[model samples]
Target: MDGIEDGAQPKKKKGMVMTIAAIAIVSVVGAGGGWFLGGMLAPEPLSSDEARVLEEAKATIKAREAAEAAHEAAPAGGEHGDAKKDDKDGLPKASTEANGVLQLDPITTNLSYPTENWIRLELALLFQGKPDVAMAEQIHDDVAAYLRTVSLQQIEGPRGFQYLRDDIQERVDLRSEGRVTNVIFRTFVVQ
Candidate 1:
C-alpha cells in the first residue's frame, strides 16, 4: 500500500507540471497574438496634406499669440484704445448698430432657483427696416428679465437650449412688434 501511494504522488506532480506548462504556453500565445493585432490595427501615418494643414494651424496659432503679445505691450491710447479699455474681458467689443443689425449689451443675471448660478448672453437683433434703439433696449431688458426667471434645469440640454431660443425669439418679436426679423445669439454662457 505504501509503495502504491508513493507511485501515485509522482503522477499527481507530473499532471500539475503539465497543467502549468499548458497555461504558460496559452498566455504567451495570447500576448503575441494581441501584440500582432495591435500593430496591424494601428492608425496609418498622417498624409502629406494633413501634415501641412496641421503645421499651418500651428503657425497660425503662434502668429495669433505673437500679435496678442504685441498688442498687450503697446500703449493703450489709440482711437480704439478706449473701446478696448471699456471691454472688461479684453475681447473686441461688438458694435451696437451696424446696418439694420443692433447688438445689445451683454445681459448677465442670476438664475431664479439657484441664485449662485448666473447666465451671460450677448444678442444681436436684425431689423426688417431701420433698427429701433428704443425697441432694442426694451427687448434687451425683457430678455435679461426673462433669463433671471430661468433655472439651471430649464436650459440644461439641446432641447432646452432650443426652447430658450424659441422663447427669446417670440419675446423679441412681441417687443419689437415684427420690426426685429431675427435674434442672433452671439454668446450664451451659464456658470
Candidate 2:
C-alpha cells in the first residue's frame, strides 16, 4: 500500500508539470502570432511623392498664416489700398481665376413641386485653358434655371444627388461647348 501511494503521487506531479508546460507554450505561441499579425497589418509609410506633397502643403499653410499675421499687424493703407478695402469680409480670397477656376455666386431657388422648399448651391467651373468669367456666369444662370425646374424628390438621397450632379455636368458641358472641363459642386443646402 505504501509503494502504491508513492507511485500515484509521482504520476500526479508529472501530469501537473506537463499541463503547466503546455499552457506556457500555448501562451508564448499566441502572443507571438498576435505580434506578427499586428506588424503585418500595420500601415506602410507614405511614399516619396505623398510626403513631398504633404510637406509642400504644410509650407504653403505656414506662409499663408505668416502673411495673414503680417497683414493684421500692419496699417490698413497700402499700394493696393482699394483692393484691401474691397475685401469687405476680411477673408483672404484665393486667386481662383489664375488657376483657371471660377467660383460662381450661390444660387438660391425654390423647388418646382414644393415651392416652399428652397435650395442653395455653390459651384466652381474649371476651364480647359483660360477661365471665361462670362461663360461661367452663363452656366451659373443655366444651373439656377435648371434647379428651378427640379423637384425636391429629385435631389434627396445619394443616388438622386449623383443624378443631379450628372445632369448639371451635362448642362455645363453643352453650355460651354467643351471648354469647361469640370463642374465642382462646393455646397448644396436645402431648407
Candidate 3:
C-alpha cells in the first residue's frame, strides 16, 4: 500500500509539470500571433506617386513663403514717389509743398539724486505736406513744458519714458491733424 501511494504522488507531480509547460507554450504562441497581426494591419508605406505629390506641395509652400517675404521687404511706391521725384528734378512745381522734419533738443527736467535725472525726450518731426510749421513748433514747446511740470517720481522708469513718447505723438497728431505722419527721435539721452 505504501509503495502504491509513492508511485501515485510522482504521477501527480508529472501531470502538474506538463500543465505548466502547456500554458507557457500557449502564451508564447498567442504573443507571437498578436505581434504578426499588428504589423500586417499597420499603415502602408508611401507610394512613388504620393511621394512626388508631397514634394511638389512642399515646394509650392516654400515658394509662397519666399514671395510673401519679398513683398514685405520691398513695398510698392504709389503717387507719393512720382511727385517727390519731380520736385527734386526742379520741374514746374504746382504746389509749394515740401517735406520737412524738426528735431528737438533733449532737456533734463527732474533731478532725483547726484547722477539720476528725469530726461525729457523730443522727437524729430517730419511731414510731406506744408502744413502749419508754427503749430508743430508749438507742439514741441508744449511737450517740453509738460515734462518740466512733472515730478521726478513720475518720470523715473522706462514706463514713464514710453508714456511720454506716446503722449507726445498723440498730442502732436491731434494738433496737426493727419498731415504729420511720422515722428522720429534724433537723440535720446538720460543721465
Candidate 4:
C-alpha cells in the first residue's frame, strides 16, 4: 500500500508540469502572431506634400462657405449683380408691367346650397389701363358677395364653373365701366 501511494503522487506532479509547459508554448505563439499582423496592418505616415494638399482643400472649403454667406445676406433684386435692383421695401420687384393685370386677395364664402361646404377663390383683374386699387377692391367685394349666392349645384361641373366665371366677368365690366378688361380666375377650391 505504501509503494502504490508514492507512485500516485509522482504521476500527479508529472501531469501538472506537462500542463504548465503546454500553456507557456501556446502563449508565446499567440503573441508572435499578433505582432506580425500588427506590423503588416500599420498605416504609413503622410508626406509633407500630402499634408499641404489637405490644408489647401480645407482653405478652399472655407472660402466657398464665406462667399455663399455673403450672397445670401444680399437683398433680392432684378439681376444677380445689379446693386440697385432691390425695391425700397427690400422685397423682390414684381415682374408685371405698368398697368398690367393685378392679382387680389383670395375670397372665401359658403355656398348657398350645402351651406356647410366652404369655397375659396383667388382672382386677377386685367385692367384696360392703369389699375385702380380702390376699384379693384370694390370688384373683389362684389365677387365675394356674388359667390355667396351661388349654390353648390350652380357651380358643380366645368360648364357650371364657366357660367360662374362669365357672370363674374360681366359683373366686373359693369362695375368698372369699361376700365377693367377681364376677370382672371387663378385658383378655386371647395371644402
Using all chains and alpha carbons, the TM-scores for the candidates as numbered come to 0.52, 0.54, 0.39, 0.51
Per-residue CA lDDT of candidate 3, range 21-137, in tens? 999999999999999999997646669997787678668757966875785566456855444332223343333234465444344354443222445464667776664658767
Ranking by lDDT: 2, 1, 4, 3
Residue pairs in collision within model 3: none
RMSD of 2: 15.9
lDDT of 3: 0.64
Question: Which is better, 2 or 3, measured by TM-score?
Answer: 2
Clashes of 4: 0
Model 2, 1-191: lDDT tens digits are: 99999999999999999999999999999999999999997756779997887688668757966876787677666565445342323433345555677778778788996675678898989988889878988999999999999998899999999999999999999999999999998889876
Return the lDDT, model 2, position 171. Answer: 98
Better of 1 and 3 by TM-score: 1
Model 1, 68-145: lDDT tens digits are 678767776667557534333454434434357777877878899667567889898999877888998999999999
Top candidate when judged by TM-score against the true structure: 2
Comparing 1 and 2 on TM-score, the stronger one: 2
Candidate 2 versus the native: TM-score? 0.54
Model 1 alpha-carbon drift over 4 Å, by segment: 1-98
**How far off is residue 157 in model 2, in Å?**
0.5
Shift in Å, residue 191, candidate 4:
1.6
Better of 2 and 4 by TM-score: 2
